[model samples]
Target: MDERSALGLLAGWVDAAGDDAAVIDGLVITTDMLHARTDFPGGTTRYTAGWRSIGASLSDVAAMGGTATAAVAAYGAPAFDAEEIAAFVDGANDVCDLTGAAYVGGDLDDHDEFTVAGTVVGRVDDPVFRHGAAPGDAVYVTGTLGRTGAAIREFERGNVERGNELFRFEPRVATGRRLAGVASAMMDSSDGLARSLHQLAAASDCGFAVEWDRLPVDRAVDAVADDDAARRELSTFFGEDFELVFTGPRAAVESTRGALGAPITRIGRVTDDGVLADGDPLPDRGYSH
Candidate 1:
């Protein structure tokens, strides 16, 4: 079974297993694990790896509409290099600081390959959930899409520096908190926009009719794909952009415009059933871990 299937099995017994993060007594908590071979591409620095790993868990906190407070990581590798470890911690600290959080340090050990498990803690008064979307709610996405797709393309084309630079995504901790007041349902697009829409549809017992032309695709996607079809494919299915996908009342958009530092684009509206993009069915495919 894949990760989602495994989580399905666990959800049978775990009440808090369904959401992006577990919330208890106003505290939001989540954990994530990554491997070098599968998660980190070749030429990825130890620093980037650290930031990406911890940033992932923080993204979960963001999905729950929480203010990230602290984070920690357990690092494992077959061999230890002093310089690499220091750089990893530095990256971790930088990412946490960017989100107004702290990197409180973690454990390290030898392993068969480079691996990192990250955990983040946060606080929320009224957290947004994935299953709260209403039929008339407007669907929105924070920032742009296809950033990771462009980065992967650059990596394949030997533009290692630019690719690595693209990999350093900032977790939307503050954005999520701001959206909490307006968002009825929310999630992170780690598994790509198409898959994220499908998941939200399933959770909220609704459907989405997304406009192909409305997606705020990243400018970097143009360097990878010039045609419209290819650009849409990359932006929707490539995943790992770490942007927040949410739903709220149509009127809520104007209230959040001046407050959110990032751009929020309305791409669609919640429907009675069936996920569709530009009038055609959109497949639930994306980055599977």
Candidate 2:
């Protein structure tokens, strides 16, 4: 069978989860990054996905509760000669340089699609796994959700307030750095909150009790879709969120919240009840691109 394609663009991040730094050491590579970059700035969008690849992988690093220290990205080209490939590398290099990460090295993979592969190296004093959540740990998130996916939906629907907030993802580097061991379990939620929570619960062998009413929504998104159905659609399965969802003891959670000096609403708590809302059960689903 041809190499299987996944359901969503964000699925790559989920697949790269789990700890084995030694195994992933220098070999963690991505073919999609090069493909996206080579087509951009000259494609229909007229902008390469090189930077986007950086942001996406960086977000993955944050989700793993680590900060990217360096990255090695390579490109595959069929038509463009060495010069064009060099420009692509330079462009990607700029992203790494700006983020204080080094461009180490990587090889090229030539194929039908112009491909880009980015292998990132990160460091964490304490690796944040998907599990480790205790029964009473509270669920919290940094920043709001759904704006990026909502923008995509709006763009596809023939309207274009197209917010680049999610597309040009700003990795929560500092946030991840600070949250290292603060939360018993930490993850950057590229998928919707529902999905991340569900995954975390399953991994930690617990459930999430959420309060849907307190969800932090972006007004830019809420403005166009004010109805309940639209709001739910935007907030629920809308993917590419890239927000941080971490859990910890109530006291530790409260302390970390105060120290972060940012807004983190306690959307729920982990329990054995299996992701509840008040006393009722909730659907633990992730977002799709």
Candidate 3:
């Protein structure tokens, strides 16, 4: 089965397994694993790998509108260079700093391949869930889309330096925290905006109608794609942006933008029908591995 389908099966077997993170008491916890060979492209730095892996887990906490507290990593690799290991730790620490979280250290093991398993702990005054969006709610996304997609394309073209700039994404921790009181539903767009909308729609039993013109397509996509249509596809369907996709009252969403002093784009509205882009049906397309 595909990753989403497998996860769906697991969710069916487990209780309260659909959220981005697990909330216990007032703490929110989440984890993620990254395989070096699969997740990182050739020429990717060890530092970038560590940063992205840890940040990915923290992004889940952010999706729940949580304030990150601490994080740990489990690293497995073959006989790797000591400098590479040091750079990896530094990257993890840097990401923790960005999220206002502590790097508590973690276990390391020798293996045939490189891999990282990361976990983050956080707290939220009011947790947002994918299931909370109501019809008529405004759907918003933080920052521009397709940056990672552009980065990947650049990497494939041997422009590793430029690609790294987009690969190392900033998790929307601060914005998410500020949105806690306002947003009704929230999730990180690591799975691409299109698939994310589908997931949110399924969770909330509501659909989405996104405005094509309103999507914050990153200009970086222009460097990778041939035309506007391809750029739009990359921005909407490529994954690993690490930006928050949220829903709230239109007024509250505007207030959130002012409160956080961050870019928040109104992309769509929640609805009773199926997902649509510019009134046309939008497929659930994104990275699934």
> Which candidate do you rate higher for TM-score, 2 or 3?
3
**Among all candidates shown, the one with the greatest TM-score:** 1
- Quantify all predictions' global Cα lDDT against the true fold: 0.91, 0.62, 0.89
Runs of candidate 1 with Cα error greater than 4 angstroms are: none
Lowest-sum lDDT 10-residue window in model 2: 38-47
Compose the digit string of candidate 2's lDDT tens values, residues 182-288. 78887767667767777788678888888878778766567568587677667755656667788888787677666663567788788885777666765655553
Per-prediction TM-score to the true structure, in the order listed: 0.97, 0.75, 0.97
Q: At residue 121, what lDDT does model 1 achieve? A: 94
CA shift of 281, model 1, Å: 0.6
Kindly list the per-residue Cα lDDT of model 3 for residues 92-157, writing each as its tens digit. 999989889998899998988888899999997699888889999999999999998898899999
Q: Single out the weakest 10-residue window by summed lDDT for candidate 1.
A: 10-19
Best by lDDT: 1
Higher-ranked by TM-score: 1 or 3: 1
Give RMSD (Å) of candidate 1 vs. truth: 1.1
Candidate 3 yields a Cα-based lDDT of 0.89
